[model samples]
Target chain A: MSPLAALSAAVRLEVVRLATVRSSAVLLALAAAAGAAGAAALCALAERADIGRSGLLEAVTGGSASGLSVVGIAAALAGALVAAGDARHGAERTALVLVPRRGALLTARTVVVAGWSAALAVASLLAAVAVVVLWPQQQLVAASPGPVVLAAPLLGYVGLVVLHGVAGLALTALLRSAVAAVSLVVAWPLVLEPLLGSVLPPSRWGAVLEGLLPAAAASRLVAAPPVAAGTPWLVGSAVAGGALLAAVSALVLLAAVRGARRDA
Target chain B: MIEALALSKRHGSRPALDDVSFTVPDGVLAALVGPAGAGKSTVLRLAVGLDRGSGAVLFDGEPYSRLPRPAHAVGVVLDPRALHPGRTARGHLRSLAAGAGVPRRRVDEVLEQAGVTGARRSRPQHFRRGAALRLAVAGALLGHPRTLLLDDPLTDLDDDSRAWLLDLLRVHADGGGSVLITASRAADVLAVADELVVLRRGRLAARGPASDLVAGLKAGVLVRASDPGLLAGAILRWGGDVEPCDDGALVVTGLDMAAVGEVARAEGVAVHELSRRTADLDAALLSLELPETELLPGANPGAVPGASAVPA
Candidate 1:
């Protein structure tokens, strides 16, 4: 068969394998819960403030962005778990045997991680919308967003979520252990990168370093002010974040594929 | 046919497998016997393209990586516990089936064939070792591969499970499939293996048909006769070696079991008990004359045209 056929089979295998994992389901549920809670809190705040259509729409957008931060963590963890699960169970031996071509197998895993993250992003968005509409706040419920206004932020959140997941998958594949990947994923963004930023003197280079950091780029995509929806700043942040995300993810993924070939 | 061509692997300067070549023709159940650290598992990993080495392994003339559908060409079981702890037996097999692009129904077929159908819904960590092994084999068989490469599959199996697995392999080989399994002990695979490939210290020690390699190993019979002295005398006169056992039995060699029976009848020596002794058969299969640490010096590591070996 052609190489594409083999890769297609491997992708189907990964999809089936991930579907049976109970932990992935739990993580997805957690993303939904986090999303709903974030949206509900923002909707309640908008209702109490007696905001108008644009303000309510901005509140909903901000809330979804807030929810995505936690969803990003969940997505990362899900990707790490999926990438390292077979190794943790010593099942990579059989996986390598069945799929022979390590490149195809690793690529299949990367595709599945991206697909799952997208799914988690959609679920989180749907849950957030449910809470916003079904919430008891009348004023917030009445402020439905224009299709483009809503689609822009939601699309941004989905792209960022996929980026987080693929990055996690590549890191875990390179490390070959979930624990090591998890430690780095948590520490690099929350502790190490922030600490580096703090140690740097306030300068132009410092600002560039901050912008280049993954957490900073990712946050820019979703950390827009409540009044900033559909504005140029939101669009600019999305463009920068999307570019960095693509570049960094490609580098990590290439490294992961190369590592898998040699390690096997 | 499975052709392992000049397979060599080096872990740094130390060789794990050195220029080892052998073949298991179609419809043969072959055993690769070696002591621990003899590179049996390494050979298997290299065979399936799971490890990079100097040489190539071909399943029906194509390398494992080049197979149109590798899983359907060669099924490998390198570890029985190579399973996710939380994945149910059915789920594991289904995943393999998906990887092999086989129908989902093949999963059930293999689970039933491996005799783990009742435990299909249960996770493998909760299974007994033999049952877990069966589950792994079931996963391998999902593609109905023409060749099977199993590593130390007979280790730690109970009598019934061992018998069942041997029967399963026999049936597979009987149906024109190639079966290759590694074992630390020759006795494990002796009865079922049509061919043998012996490795010692990362080198090929011997490779030939099981019976040819076992030639010149003496086969004897034990008999407890009412007239022990008479039977001994007759067997000795017949040029068969006879030895008196402490248990009042005669150990007769150089004669078949039937010959011993006929001699007893002719001499009017009433035989109380008679049985064939396979004490040497085990040793013969493993070529026990060589010391455990002894490497086969100047041994031909390449494929032999026919049945030829160094005193095996």
Candidate 2:
């Protein structure tokens, strides 16, 4: 078989293997549930806001954007968990021994992670839209379906989530420990970003720097689009997030190759 | 065919395998006999390209790493525990076949061949040591590899499983597939081995046909007498080594059974038991377990006489 065919087969096998795990099933279920709940809660809170009749109705009908952050975190965790699962069971050695070429195996893993993340992103978005439509203050605006308004943000959000998964997989390979990889993936956004943000000013430059953080990039994608001045910051954050994901993935892949070779 | 040339592997300052080299021709079963930590596993890993080494491992005529699909070229069972705990026996075989681009039907064939078809749906955690080893072997054979590199494949097997495995290996070798197996004990698998490559501290001590190596060891006679000490002394005086056997008997090496019997009869020692004990694979292995320093010409700095020599 051709190399590409072999890689595809390998990735498909990995997906099946990961799907059968109890941990992957639990994590995916939690992420979907959190996304749905967050959407409902955000829509309820938006209906209570006294901004204006039209604004309040519109807000309530659009579902809470806050759920995006939880979904992002959950997606990141899922990615990390999937990548770290192999190391936990010592399956990485088997994979490497069979495949031999470290780069091919890493590529297959990244592809599987990205594919799963995309599916989750779409499912969560649809669930949130359904919840928003069922809100009490729902009104049909010119953008009734919310697809045109949400398409770009959804893509960006999903991209950010996929980046987290890739980064998690890479880190897990480098660390060779699932607990450490998952902790680092979750803590970087929840703990480290806030501390770093406190030290930097809240100006344009500071916002750009913050966007480089994994959490900020994910939030910038899903957060309600800024009215006038914050557009540039959102764009910059998206770009920086993408860059960080690529850079970290590359670095982790290199480390994984070295470790696999050294261990072998 | 498989070849390991000048392979040297060191864990820290201690040498696990120091400049060990050997080759197995196609369609032959070669047994690597060594004690634990004698670099047997290291040699298997290097041959399968699972572990890196300073020397090269060639398959057929090319390096193992350069094979298009290495699984199809060299099947290896390095560790039985390398399988995923969550995957069932069948699932694991299917995954391995998929990764190697082998036909899905091959999975069932292998499972049946390994006699694990009844437990195909069972998870690997539920498998006993023998079952796990069979699964490992089945996985390795999924791609119909030309060469099999197995390390201690008979470690935890019962007599029935060992006999089945021996038959399987013999069949594979007869089908023009080379087999290289390393084992701490040689009693079970040695009968089928065409070549015996003995390793001492990661270096090749001897390489030849198994029969030749066994025959070259000193002849011996199994003798039983009431006064074993006197019989041993008489045997020793005849330039022979006496190995105490169970039931108060002595296996005297370096002397024929008739000569030993004659000596015992002449010395008025009762010859209750008298039989020739040909040096088997076990005896040959014992003779090959020389000091590590002796394998290398200049490994030991101190030139102490007889220190590096092992009594045969």
Best by TM-score: 2
Q: Pick the candidate with the highest lDDT.
A: 1
TM-score of each: 0.82, 0.84
For candidate 2, write residues B90-112 as lDDT tens digits: 88887777677788899999999
Encode model 1's per-residue lDDT on B236-278: one tens digit a residue.
9998988788999988888989999999999999999999986
**Candidate 2: clashing pairs of residues:** none
lDDT, candidate 1, equals 0.76
Ten residues in sequence with the least summed lDDT for candidate 1 chain A: A59-68
Interface RMSD, model 2, angstroms: 2.7
Instruction: Give me candidate 2's TM-score against the actual structure.
Output: 0.84
| All candidates: DockQ | 0.49, 0.39
Candidate 1 residue lDDT tens string, A1-264: 467977888898888888776787798899888778777777777756755654443443434332236777778788888778776777666777777767777788878988999988778778877877787745664565556555655576787778778777777777777777767766766687788878877999888776766667665665534553456666667666766577656857675657565646
RMSD of each: 6.1, 5.3
**Alpha-carbon RMSD, candidate 2:** 5.3
